[model samples]
Target: KFCNETSDEVDRREHPNKHFICSFADCKATFSKLWKLEAHYSRHTGLKPFACGDCEKSFCTRYQLTRHHLSHSGEKPYLCSVSGCSDAFSTPGSLRNHAAHVHHQKENSYVCNHQGCGKEFRKKKQLKFHICEHTNELPFECDFEGCNDKFASSKALKRHWKMHKGYPCDEEYCNFKGKTWSEYQKHKKTAHRVTLPCDQCKKMFHNAWFLQKHKQSVHSGERRMFKCIREGCEKSYTTNFNLQNHILVFHEGKHDFACPFAGCGKAFAMEESLKRHFVVHKPQKTKLQVNLCDGCSMCFLIHYILEMLL
Candidate 1:
């Protein structure tokens, strides 16, 4: 019968999964129906109608347009499940590529063979940097005399050579040097002499250590060793250095070192030095007090004189 013969022909053409094959020569595309095969063959004949709204880009299939939209929106929907990285990609293929390149360090990855260096990298660019050490290649060198240091980069060598030049100190009556201008300023404020005044109080100190000690002893009032002679006042200091700072900042009392010359508002370190300096002027203070008792009057005109007199 004709019906039986048609059934036999259908059975012969059907695959194990009940899917039909494309009749086009040299094509092995599978389709569930004959119309599906005809629709797929139209792709080989250059039949494209789909277009994108953003860029007018055309594709033959809706799936292709869906993939292209990810590029336009910068939407990386696909992600790699690697340990250290959470990189997202636009397509599954790209996600797989990132995992192999970055996460897994695939078989094709370059590894440094230098002894004592067991570093492995996924990119050839990183490997090239490591190879520089094995070859002893100094790409950056200083041209200065008596300087033979080489660096990996030219910027590092340039910075290293600046150490030969003296840097300026930013303090009054202080002559200091450093490798850089910023470092010089820091040292001048912290180590040699503090030029920057405190914002809270208009006080000057030779260094930050002295300034901190002054603040803790005088301003903070936490410890008080140099107590006021007046009753009911508790004060202390950690050291004599801090005690001296407290006297200078709080008491505002002048010691024996006072100005010698008439109309000169400057003070000297000692009274005898001030007297010797006043000799250069036209007139000087004539109240020359002498010691009658050597044991009782131990004080002298200057600290050095007092040391010798004792």
Candidate 2:
């Protein structure tokens, strides 16, 4: 018997593999068991019943609190078994990530096959997400009504759902909001004007991760070229994002962005093209009433008005 439906017991009997849905607002997450649903609901409620005795940190789950205790105790139970390399981590997940990046460089690395883009990822799932950037393929579609949002990964889609129901900043007179708990923490850091500067170019970024990404993309000698696949089109772009825009405009004819001004409903595939089109609707500046001085060949607005006044 389910709380949300009168005939849920009958429905469950017919569909034995039916999942329990999370009751959190705008969250479409489903779990196999009722206990899993209850555990997931804590994320939206921001409830942390498990508190650490050593510090003021709290976690929604007991397992998470147990993991945090390892950091304070300086205990590294998870160790790398690779020959001649000794590294340990508090969590098994950390150990796995390190093993993938460090130990499995040649055999287990997932390399991208796209021309000019040879980015390697630790996991095949990460490689799949990176391929979407090159192909402009968005497979994860949001089920929210009136929203046609799509993402390359399920994680991105989950983060986007939080924007509809995630908690806002508790600071007074501030309307800052985030789509995830990590994003909220990032906002707090940025609100205080905390910045990370690049060592090579000295460009300031909002966070360390962004700064690292900037360094890898700009400073690193890695360049990618995406070309149009359409017949008779010899166009190539520096990025896949730009190549996607070219395809939408020239081949697919996906003119989604429309001019907001009334009576001139011209649409464009790219937002930049629509922005450039806005200049066509701009009001012409009024020309200044000026008279050319016969003596010095100088133009003066006051000279024309002063002659009429005289």
Candidate 3:
């Protein structure tokens, strides 16, 4: 049977009592339990009985309703037990998947066969996303109003949606923000490792694009070709893009970008400025040096250890 044809024909033939088939037309989804079959049937019948109290959203299953409740609570009950890693998720499935894909490594079965690029992935979806980079294929397009942006993957599209919705960096103490999802990712990279350095001035940048832009404006003495045409405005920029940004920020006075955090209605003219302002709202981490080693004078930087001990 095809992948989409979810009928367990072989299993049904061997043990008919063990398989529960869907009575819905053309959808022969086989389930082991009665409750599972009922839940699956809800999708066919368009019945969503489990409605969320906080929102108008409804789910076909109780498990989905329980998972959706975490969003309102902002609670991450499932935590990774892996040492030196601090990752949390709202659902047990997400936590399990994270542990399998991140903490544990397996032989990558799916390999990108693109020329000069043989990137391997544990999942076929990952390999498909990687292949898009080589092919320059952006199948996932942003459906946000007035936006024509496209992404290679659903992950990229989701992140791009966060940019439109004014989501800030969740990293503690990091105020870096970007106008685009790729820029936000590039900024996040600097938190873990040293960023790329300019060859001339040795000034570090998050990526090559910033490094090249620095070289053009600072080292190459690229003239401010784009001057503000607005009366009484003497502002100039190396690119027309920057000039337009200045106009939008200063003359237009558009501060539609609001803080994404609940109960915080703070707005900013630029996303970068809003990101910088967001750092103050993050829960401050209490850093402490703990002597983990009894044998030697070795100390380790631990966060929230004092709070936990108290």
Worst 10 residues of 1 by lDDT: 290-299
Candidate with top lDDT is: 2
Rank all candidate structures by their TM-score, best first, as comma-separated numbers: 2, 3, 1
Residues 23-48 of candidate 1 have per-residue lDDT tens digits of 66655567666556655755444344
* Candidates sorted on lDDT, descending: 2, 3, 1
RMSD of 3: 26.8
Which wins on lDDT, candidate 1 or candidate 2?
2
Better of 1 and 3 by TM-score: 3
Q: Each prediction's Cα lDDT score?
A: 0.58, 0.69, 0.66
lDDT of 2 by residue, 1-310 (tens): 3556645455555556756865555554666765566567665554565677654344666777888788656589888888887988888887888987987634468999999999988799999999999998999998888888989998899888877877687777989777778888788766855566777775776544345445644677754556789999999765444676789888998998899999998998865567656656773542434454342222334453323211
Q: Write the per-residue lDDT of candidate 3 for residues 1-310, one digit (tens) a residue.
A: 4446434666587557767887866554677786687687665444566777654345767878888787656589888888988978888788878988897834458978888887778798888888877888889999899999988888789778877775356667877667775676566666655467778875776444345545644587434356789999897654343455578779999786789989888887655446555655763542333323232222224533222211
Top candidate by TM-score: 2
TM-score of each model, paired residue for residue: 0.27, 0.34, 0.29
Candidate 3 local lDDT, residue 16: 72
